[model samples]
Target: MKFIDEAIIQVVAGKGGDGAASFRREKFIPKGGPSGGDGGHGGSIYAIADRNINTLVDYRFARLHRAKKGENGRGSDCYGKGADDIVLRMPVGTVITNAATGEAVADLERHEQKVLLAKGGAGGLGNLHFKSSTNRAPRQFTFGEPGEELELKLELKVLADVGLLGMPNAGKSTLIRAVSAARPKVADYPFTTMHPNLGMVRVDQNRSFVMADIPGLIEGAAEGAGLGHRFLKHLTRTRLLLHIVDMAPLDENIDPVREAKAIVKELGKYDESLYQKPRWLVLNKVDLLPENEREKICKKFIRSLGWKGKSFTISALSGEGCKALTYAIMEHLEQESGIGNEEQIT
Candidate 1:
């Protein structure tokens, strides 16, 4: 299935029914008084978060959504029935906003979460409600109000504990495959991953975390080389970031340190908060270097980049140093969360 994360839609709530005015005229005791029933309320529109749904493709095709109108009131004290409500199921990470006013409406993080998108109008009043001593035979009835309508924009941001950041073909996909069961297409080319891919890495029996891999970010990406928002939006939902640097690029002319710096610069330009998130450096493809020079080369690159944070040297394809990396990530996430390490996310 093609992954679609963005969509726009229009929602219209049902209109309320009109009130009724009547008089009781039976074959018994002359005039009894007003005997009108109230109108039923209109149907409302609601949204629910479904974990089973990972894409917004369905909403892309069906852009307009409307609810049913309520029934009108009858004359012989017969109250009308209210219409059923409409529920829209969307992905768990979906965020809904008012397209016109740029106001945020909802951020669905948990499964089975529901929020109201449009409110239904209230029911109209009946003539029986206006009965009094002076106006016993009154013929007053209030009209129902109109339902609410809105244009909304839905954006899905994938939720993960860790996110991978790097240049094109920096071994992110290979690293994810080594750590988890996700098998994203890998090739000897750039932009192999056009969409985001998620993998679940388990360190122990019950200890696991989700990792996300997005398309490679280039030097001019923030200005327009790529849709800056689309590329970096998924990282905002992550708790940690892994900056994967290709310690051994196939092209001898390419500077790994320069490419790494460019990647971080683009990240900061896209979102400052995302740039401020906890990040660790992973020098990938150490197998390409000689075992004796591995430590020296990795140390030199980290030093030249002025990086003083957590660092690791790993061969993403050979599974070397992958286990230690996953364990460290699991520990960091657990420590930051201040909870048990057994809770799993979908």
Candidate 2:
């Protein structure tokens, strides 16, 4: 299925049924009173979150949704039938916003979460309700009320514990595949991953965390360069970030250190809070380097960059040093008091 993270749609609730204006004319009773019944209420519109869905691709083709209208009232004290409510199922972690007011209406984070988008109109009164002692043979009925309509914007942000950040072809996809069950497209060229992919990385028998592999960031990613800000917003929900750098670059034109610095700068420019998140430096493709020089090269890069936090050297392709990296991530995630705690994190 094609990945679609954003969508726009219009929702309309059902209208109420009209009242009847009639009087009973029985054979035995010559002076019969009004016998019109009340009208039924209209159907409402609702949005529900489904964990099975991962994208907003369904809304891409169908943008408009409307509920059925209530049936009109009939004579002889017959009430109209109420319309059925319309329910729209969306992916978990969907943020709904009102297009006209530019306000966030709801953020569905849990499975089976539901929110009311539009309300149906109330039913109108029938002629029998207006028949009183003074007005016995009255023929007064009211029309049905109109339903509410609005335009909405839906945006999906993947829920994860760790987010992978790197330049194009930095072995992020490979690392995720090696650690988790996710099978993203892999190739020698850049921009092979155009959408975000999520996987569950298990550190131990009972301990595990979700990881998200976002699209590669370019030098001017903060300024909407290359793939732009669509993928950058996905990192906001992550508790930790892993900066993947190509230790042995296939292209002689690319500088690993320079590319790493550019990515950091872009991240700070986009959101300062992103820089404050717990981060780890990962050097990938170490298998391509000479065995004796790998340790020395890794130390030299760390010192040159003036990095004080944790760092790891691994080969994502050969799965060398992947277990240690996963354990380190699990340790870091557990150290933070509320990082993985369900009650505190949301």
User: What would the TM-scores of all predictions be?
Assistant: 0.95, 0.91
- What are the per-residue Cα lDDT tens digits for candidate 1 across 56-100? 999999999998777777787877788889999999999999999
Off by over 4 Å in 2: 337-346
Question: Global CA lDDT of candidate 2, please?
Answer: 0.90
Model 1 stretches with alpha carbons more than 4 Å out? 227-229, 340-346
The residue pairs that clash in candidate 1, if any, are none
